[model samples]
Target: MASNPYEVEHGIKPSAPRQTRRPDMSSFHSALHELLPEPSSSSSNRNVGPTPDALRSLFTLVLDQMTALRNQAPAGVDTELLQGLIEELVVDREHPDMKGFLTQDDLDALDRVPKKQLKQGELCPICTEAFLDDPYPLVVVLPCSDERIDPATGLTIHVKHEKHRFDLECVGPWLLSKGSCPMCRQDVNAEKKRKEIGNQERKKANAVDDEDEQDIVDGLYG
Candidate 1:
């Protein structure tokens, strides 16, 4: 299997054991709300979103907290993953055009799979930790069908199985920065946008066909 580019770039070994001490979810959530306050209902601020500075501050705050948590953990707990993520975010901040981050809506739309459904040995491609390891694992299935069109033959090809699962925490930041499957390097957001456009075009064609049928009926009767 081809190596995930992100892993290769960051020197992340998929076989590394996950850190036993998980970051506090509530603390992170609290930090997020504090950094990016909810928009007011007033007409002046109704549709306004957080400024770039605000977002930068939030990222810094989260990274600092994560680093602190990592420091408190026992030795041999892999911290490379978190450091790799921070480096990637820094690069993304420097070069805005390089970012292919997924939107909140895109992340929200992913299918969540219960931890119990995953096999015992099944590991998240990003963190390489078994899904069952986390007591409250937030596992989500990637939308990649592992299907592609053969440019030479003009035929569709199935590269592999349709479902690719990952730990939400492990994959979320990756998708937010890179917008691709960590396992196959499939462009998730691009595929989603393509499907949406296809659906819209099909709906438009159907509408036109309906109108044409109505016109034909009127012509014959009148």
Candidate 2:
């Protein structure tokens, strides 16, 4: 939301909420609770602690959501950033290094998960339909996987098996965000810089080529 790491790592806040939609889990409620369980709700001063299983579940939940978001991403959104974020999350959860806790790059990398494809007659994550009763229907296969985290390490070390495809039209708009995927909690900005760098490189290359061609033409004509 701060658009980059300088803002995120420095604890810079966004001017306004990014989502005008319901269910913003990016804040303390989901972010903190997912990592650590809330204190005892029943007792005003009682302290409840987070369990290892809760940590596992939270990471697992994030992973599953990411996988779903990635698999269901539309044509417009690419899985590059989300996929990268997943890898980082895996590292953080596994390593448990508070000394270097989440850096800006790490924060920038973290974003939404992909969507899961529909099953035979299973409703789409979006449309809530197969759009028909077609089993083994012709579709785009958005590849996805299941992850397993090490309880001792507090991280996801590996993924297993691939999940199936999805409908493009159904999942596009969410994936079209500038930095992150939909279903993300606290996304980082990505595409803009890469795009700018690409454009600059292309311009330089084209400029050199144009100069060479112009020289050649001048020599030939002269």
Candidate 3:
């Protein structure tokens, strides 16, 4: 109510229009961010794992190492040569009449293994059965140092021969596991290595002898 009638006659405008009391939206704006946070560099928002860039770097390093190893790795010709010789030995042993395969194994000893069937009393220790009464029964040969009668000298001679034979099935497992003769326990691998060393030594000696022989022939011609 207009208390003073005299003031109203002058029109004082009610004390600067009664300043309005606005609501405090500063706290409301702050609370909006707290409740619904913006998507940014917050730790909780990121996935926990190795980054893609890091994985790419690791893979690149592996590829480089593999490439380096491939460049430096040897061709393994010696291993391959040895394997080929072993296979050749098998082939030559099967077909002695066939020509053109180098072998250290004695073909005479191979053929010397009695083709006669095993006696009924001679039971295989592994299978505990006599040789099968079939047309073909497999017999395996292994390296051994055994004595044999010298035909010319009439004296006993110790020789490296494949005299021992066993059932194919029994010998196969035994060779793989032990690389040895089943009866004598003589290592075939050892024998093979020894033969290889001997062959190399012989080759070296022969090469030296050939050089000497050529020198003598040259001197004679000169």
Candidate 4:
């Protein structure tokens, strides 16, 4: 039997195919309330909320525990969807103002590869479904890059790119919940924000340089 694509990539075997169910929002909110420390009744502390760092720590703990539980779950039971939902819930509770999903603009900015460009029998890492199976497939490539120092060579080594194509349908929801590539765990949203900041900084620097050059020319001409 052919190895399951997801299992091959992630090492966790699924006993059967299962539909991902929508998470119960009320239950998630209640659970978050329990996990987070309540506001103090004292006048001085009543308005204080959990610090961002504290919330981040709690989120990491919850995700780690949930991932372990999913790995240990009986085969054929699908807990991956639930795990993602819980993660989004935690993010929402911790930082309500923060956007957790890729905006439409972000999605539009992704490189769309033609379906024919995909190798035969290629499957989406998220759903493990063959991309060609769908009559109409919208495929997008993730911009993922990672590097590590080779212990033996003591030199920086760029990791070889793996299968990073996915049906938009399969990956969209996952990115919406996590703002990351499901296969690589690369934080796509965060990277985009960093790039935007870099661009802004460059523009500011160029403007200052242009102003300084103009001032120098005026002084020389006068």
TM-score against native, each model: 0.55, 0.26, 0.34, 0.43
Clashes of each: 0, 15, 0, 0
lDDT by residue (63-160, candidate 4, tens digit) is 54444445655566655664674566466556643234454346667778787787777866544556777666678887665666656545444452
Candidate that beats the other on lDDT, 1 or 3, i.e. the better one? 1
Best-performing candidate as measured by TM-score? 1
Error of 2 at 12 (Å): 49
lDDT of 2 at 93: 52
lDDT of 4: 0.56
Query: How do the residues 63-174 of candidate 1 rate in per-residue lDDT, one tens digit apiece?
Result: 5544554466457656565566556556545543323546455678888997668888776654455678877888888767655665655544445343578777656655
CA lDDT, every model vs. true structure: 0.60, 0.40, 0.40, 0.56
Worst 10 residues of 1 by lDDT: 213-222
Highest-scoring model, lDDT: 1
Question: Where is model 4 more than 4 Å wrong at Cα?
Answer: 1-100, 148-162, 194-222
Candidate 4 has which clashing residue pairs, if any? none
